[model samples]
Target: MLQASFGSQHPSSDARKVADWALRSHDNRQAAFIIIDKRAARLYVLDEAGRLRGSTSVLLGAAHGDDTVPGIGQRAISEVRPGERTTPAGRFLAERGHNGRGEDVVWVDYDAGVSIHRVLTSNPGERRLARLASPVLADKRISYGCINVPVAFYETYIRPMFARQPAMVYVLPEVKSVDEVFAMAASPQR
Candidate 1:
């Protein structure tokens, strides 16, 4: 069996609960796994054995919710209505790739145009870096649906996490309980 260890500082209360269950489960244990806590605006990267590899703040969708809007990915960021933006909460077999912009990223839910990549600096007006460095999670919610992360953090942690294989990404729900999103992954025998 794989061993486990905690690497990041204490996670949010809700994150702790879901992580507790994830720790007990074995389904996603053989591969690198990531836990995106939208409510806390944090992402925790864990190793194949469930040991915490790294953790960093992340920028999520502008709207607060657990589901992604259908067809939102086809439209321009300006065309998407406010509520349509969401970093859907669920499991994803995320893989690495180069976006149309030629930037390397890990697509969490490609159909929804949701991917985790370095903070977008193309639009300085977005003030993405400032938002990510802010002392509050509220300011971090500015993306359409993608999870924006610091370049250093993305390179140092995220990229390496999925370097060898496709990692499982678990985006914890903000609108729903952890039990709801991770019900199947959380087996009692775990």
Candidate 2:
């Protein structure tokens, strides 16, 4: 039940950079999410909105490769890879839940079985899961194919975004053309 107001000012270095860019570019009138490919990361938050509020970073699926499933769109690096690791590109939704640590998380259910939850750091192997780890996990990639945000950010901004129900989480391969992806997502699934 943590609110967005709690950590509105303490965005991560990456999140702060994205917010600054977005605010200057968009004038903070709309809500936006940024995907950082080179870093295999993502940022979610409400724009300026007359005041800064809510933010978090996520581990993405692997970059494109031969093992990527075609028609499923570009794979993000943080997604599960059968036995490796990978994330997928396309539109998605963020639900809510608690991780093993019992921290509130935004459950981004994208590719089947893939979800973004709080960093679950209970063991050694789990620690090396992703590049970004909290003081707790410090090294685990627990997601199957979804983005994971720190508990603090998730509760502050993400939770409220979905309060109205059905919040959209768009995943693009890069900053390239998103028309095709959006069009396909809007069209009925055949």
- Give the candidate number with the greatest lDDT: 1
C-alpha root-mean-square deviation, each candidate:
3.1, 8.5
lDDT of 1 by residue, 15-129 (tens): 6665555656665656778888898898888776677888888999999999988887787778998888899998788999888799889999988899999999888998989
lDDT of 2 at 118: 51
| Residues 1-30, model 2: lDDT tens digits | 112222435544433443344344442224
Weakest 10 consecutive residues, lDDT, candidate 1? 181-190
Backbone clashes in model 2: 22
How many clashes (backbone N, Cα, C below 3 Å) per candidate?
Answer: 0, 22
RMSD of 1: 3.1
